[model samples]
Target: MTWTDDDPGQGEPPAILGLAKLRTARAQEIRRAQDTLTTASGDAGVGWQAQSQTAFAAEVQKTAGDVELLAVGMEKQAAVLTQYAGQLSQLKDRQRILEQRRASAKSSLARANAMMPGGLFSEPTPAPFVLAGEEDSTAEAKAEEEARQRAAAESKIAAAQADLRAIESEWDALVADRRRVDQSCSTALEAADILGAVSSFSGSAVSAASPGDLLDRLSVLSAIDLQVLLAAHPELAEKLQAASTQDVATWWNALDAEHQQTFIVGLPNIIGSLNGVSALGRVAANRINAANRLEAIERTLADWKRQAAQPGSFTNATSQISALEDEIKYLRGAVSEPPTVQLYLYDKDADRIIEMIGTPSPETKRVVTYTPGTLANLDGFYSGDTQSIADWLHKRDEDGMVAFVVKDGRYPQNPLTEANDQQYARGIAQNLADFEEVAFTDPLLEGRQSVAIGHSWGVANITVSEALGAHYDKVVSLSGAGAPADWTPSPTTEYRDFSYDDILQFAQDIRVGEHGAVWSGRNPREVGFAHEDYYDAPLTWKSFPGNGLVNPLLAAAGGIESHNLAASTAPGNLTLLNDMRDFINEAGAPR
Candidate 1:
């Protein structure tokens, strides 16, 4: 694009105050559009007689509002440009003055140099800076005489060089204000842009109908129209989250597969996190999201490097750099390694991940998702041995069992401090419930038996999720914790919970004892289960409720060990490990 001195509307804003006159003209043009919208919105406030009168008026008002916002955004952008131009003018003026000071310093430094034996005070341009102590072969004086000759000259040269450095510093600071202005303005303009800068700029408005309403409207709308709406409001599809999973699944499944992939490609981050998307679709979409995250990291890393060019920046930002690098390594490994795993859900905002060990298809007979306990994080999953549990289960799939690892979530990080906290479980239950319903509702796996498996606090997560209406054929808890105060399981769903009767088992008292369950504490043993058993299978059951000798010492180590999983293939008590594997195998497939 080429711009004459005629107008800013012709091209980009130039970096001078005179050019801001052009930007002001552009702002005036935008204000005219805003004035038109303001008038239209006023007219829409009146009564009109027709069935669609309300709808038409609403459209006018919305369109008008959007145009007004666009005008505002453009005006704000122009205002910033003008402000920046003024700042630039002032900085340039100051920079010119600083240059004069620097020249004087350099001339004075040359005079100081002349006081030394070899230097000439009369040089027009200062000689290239040289150290003060260099022996001037022309000096044939005694020690005291030479010291007296050099002392005042050395001080003058030092002062001149120091002044030169300070002037240069001032010049750098003065110019850098331009970047500061640009950054601040860009940030503010971005916020205004969110008021539909790209979409509303043309003053086009779509339906104000909700997500479920859009489902109906979508049927009659063209694909291009859908794109326009989605482009403008990515949340149009995302709002389906509040609708029924079955409804969402049905609506989504009705779209052409190509359309589905296209939507995923267009907004992978938002689509990947939505329920009712097919696991396959979510996996593909979430992978894109992960790549996008890594790309974002790369941009941030580049920005850091640019900043690092300045002294002291590296020291201040080293930790941030390390974090970025680690995330890169983790994300790269996640996208590529452990070929068995597929990215199902990668919600960067929530810091959550759900990885599938094997693809679920129409023929798949069974599916299982494992939710981890406290202190589980992205680093633990991608960098540590967390995938092994799902990998181990997937390995034994002779027929058709797909395994998933809820490798990371917003679970509490500090076990010791959070051992008593049950709010995390309650908080994530509905989301977990929604996740299962949507992720597994596809035709490919509709008939497959499903298992909800969890360990430690994760058990409480699944249990509360079940209470919230997540359907599962079976529930398995490994060293489970308490659900919410009034938790109850569905009578139809079978439940099996295991605990080592260890110190961790006793830790449940903090939650269950401190807070009461409807009848018993959140202890899985107390909660009704069709078939609940301990891994060790002690000689005496005692139903575990009667008065009897309870040995905390015996179960202490094993109990703590049981809270965390040591995959079937990992080194542990052979008998207990073997039993656990057998149990997982049983829980994983159709009975």
Candidate 2:
């Protein structure tokens, strides 16, 4: 029970001490069993009992080996407990020192007050001494000088008391910290003891095999074999799925590039979609799967072309070929060479990417994610307008890094039909929120201001995400369609922009039953939610006064065009972008 800095058992609780003793006992028992087995195996035996004795000895040796491993693990757990206990002791000692210093400060302040002329609490008073036969002017001058000196002395006393109070406050904080540390140490010791006991029977034992051997075997497993392994041991898969991102990243980095490629290639489905897998790993796995898909599609297209050329082919191979060609083009574009920006979290199937025009690392002061409206797809995600908006933000604030992401949600082939589906918006919101969670978890992106820009359907998605408790510093909805009736934007700075002539807002009004049965739910513009601000864009024709004479005839056209003007790189949209940027910067300003 004696404590020492170097002693592994020092400062450990009684429970840990008991576990340590048990481990020692088990180690000795294992050693004895091993020795007896060795002796029996070497002994010259005869008859049928020899075979039985040898088998029994082998079983005993195996059991002893497992027990020895368990004992070693328990010993490590005990050492961990002892280390935590040592930390607790040191914290307690520091706490005592701070308390002593605070007490000394208090005593010094008391002594300082005693040494003062009157008392620390006494008010200043003029001296009683008055010169006899002296003029009144002289007496008044002496009284004024005495009063000034007393005031100075009182100020010094007050400063000394303030310093002592500050010291006492610091000491109190230190004591609170010490208590927390002590509790944490206690919890650690208890956890270690419990885990140690569980470890003894937790079925974690592997045949004395090297980890490299297991990895090598895994590297050669086929997709079916891997799936079977997953099916057979889902608990292990669950553990891998729940591991921290850093841990998964570490594991992924340890493998050589070739092995990493092979491992993921063999089990792309699992690795690509597995939660808790590092973004880097997911990107790599998805890239492989994307390539495989492209190759498969190309082969199919080649086959179709060959069939279409054959004589008397009754099937309409032309349409099939056209569809495949379009798909190939889109897929190729998605994983195309020389990417325009840094891509993170790319899922070809879902066509969602947490991309960045500028680095979204910790060094970046601001990170903005832009969700595009209806008909947005990977093929058109990097259009000129998208790049222009990203460039505008980056140029506007040279000191800050801005990333515009098009987190396209799943939509049907015909987007118009799915535009009002709240369920679709909710699903997209979940995806965006999950991406945010993963992004913020990175040490480099921690605490950075995050803004979400939603255009058309994106507005609904972002709104729903916020309502679902997604965190955003600022949200800007451009021509938002509507939101669920019961949903409200999360507590954050929100901005809404709508064109005065935009027919889409009017159309959404009809869809949401605002003018007539609520279609969607509530138009964000009419929701009465206290938004930070709203921008109303003029619906003038791009030509303006030049087309004024015929503007009335083109009014509908101008309005229809204005719906997209807010989010576009069109000259007229510059005002909206500037206003949005101002709002974003204002919201992020220090309170």
Candidate 3:
């Protein structure tokens, strides 16, 4: 079923407000249980104490339920956030690479221009040498001298031509690089911005006063929160239900089927809210407009190229070309991309996945282990998301295997809940250990080489396993959590850290156990997304901003904005998948 949140009638609603309320409810239940337990323990009657114990048991179950729901919400939210961040990171990287290439081209162009015109290699005019009383040289001697001079001049001219040609080659290379970089950077940055904006919206939901407030902010919901909110405010839900449904459906039909499915599963609130649908439509329209602008500029460049090919057309085309480039660059910066979601597939069966990903070359045996941070889902799969990476690797690497392990082995049903930060970290570790055990046990994996790629929580999982004595070759963590003081990596551990958000619980938790020791002591490659930041020049969410729980409006805005950010660089995410495949091929390790 296509679920959408683009209905205008639904109004702006918080994406994760319902889950937050669920967490709050669990908290309340826990508090109530404690109170009853305390009172019962102080009572004289055993029967009353037993009753209290039973009640506590029931409360605990409810608490667990709440926790599960909340965890689901957190997981979903985390998935959305990571997807956006990862895509943005990719966009930033591509843009930087492209810009660097472009800059080199510009430098080469400058040199070439100087050499070609009246600059560096310009031919110098010779002045006649007239000695005061010197007789004129004989005609025959003068002619011979003139011939030699002519030869020398010709040689100098040839040399200059060669130099100019070399510079032109450099210029051409640079131009190509610049074009690639520009296009890639533009697309990626736009995607990142949109997703970032959505994330900003959701991030604000952390402090929503109630689920209703949050739902109102999301401006879309036909499920859970809206249902709950409707239960609370029957009149409002009833009044808006019919219009919201139609509006959401209409909006859903406008999007691609895949997107439609994603919207429903990930953004239930939007499906029920007409306003959310409208906002989403507006965002989509903006993305389309940006695409159109890019296309138009591309056409203009093509026309310029055609005109430049005509005799004397360079003079006319040059200035226009420069102007067009400037305009494209600006438009690229301005355009926003659609939101993207990451999908992480934990492939317990690597060989099959490997074959599924790439062309068949040989019967290869390999292992792939994936670990991801919070908020993962099947719904939010995108180009640069971990799953996309895996897909790329599968297609590109003919012989490699792949696998994934979710943070805490917990894919919460809801995307809103205070995470059991410790358990989540510990669980991923357990997952890795289990994989190792399985690898050793399986004939296919026995003696087969493997690599582990972890991001955020996944990094913790791999580190924890290594601490507990698991083995793997080349562990890469993308934007991993915990500092060197938190996770120590030695011979078996390799750390690749992405510089992103500040690590909070990860640092504290890794400080707890011997695993904590491992967490605290690893050197990671800290690559900054500054490349993208410099290019896209990310801005904070303007419409909504605050602790998500405290502000419904911000939370709602964050969700949409983050989605856009993730989507913008989604193409690069797809490229990453190819990189993964290439990595496998280069390693020549069987999957």
The model with the greatest lDDT is: 1
Q: What would the per-residue lDDT of candidate 1 be over residues 1-591, giving only the tens digit for each residue?
A: 232221212223354445556646766786786676556545544465554565655656655554555545556656666776565456556756776898899999988999774456422332344467754622433444557657878999999999999987776676465556555654554453533323332212233555665555555433333444565566555465566667668877998886686567655665676677788888878777677788989999989878988776644688888778877876775467543347787765678788787877766878887888777777666564666665666777766778778844588677655634656566677777767776667887776888777777777788878777777877776676656656777666667666655455566554555564321366776676544455553322232323345664443444455545433234543455455456655643342
Q: Which ten residues in a row have the lowest lDDT in candidate 3?
A: 528-537
Model 1 gets an lDDT of 0.63
TM-score pick, better of 1 and 3 = 1
Q: For model 1, name the residue pairs that clash.
A: 502-559
> Tens-digit lDDT track for model 2 on 405-498?
7664564344456776676678778877666666555444556788777777777777777777677777777777666655765545555554
The alpha-carbon lDDT assigned to residue 75 of candidate 3 equals: 44
Candidate closer to the true structure by lDDT (higher is better), 2 or 3 = 2
List model 3 lDDT by residue over 1-591, tens digit each.
111222111211233345445545654665565556556545546555676667666655544543444334434444443444344345445545545665665565555444442457434444456577543554455566556555655555566566556655655554454455444533442242223222323322424334334434434432233333333344443333334333443444455645543344443332422232432332333344445657977997988788788886534667678766764654464353422211111221231111112211124355566655445542232213535444545544445453432332444333223123444455456655644654333333345566676654455557667666677766655544433234445544333333222232223245444454323423244321111121121322322434344465454454334333321335523433333344444543322
Q: State each candidate's clash count.
A: 1, 2, 125
The TM-score obtained by model 2 is 0.50
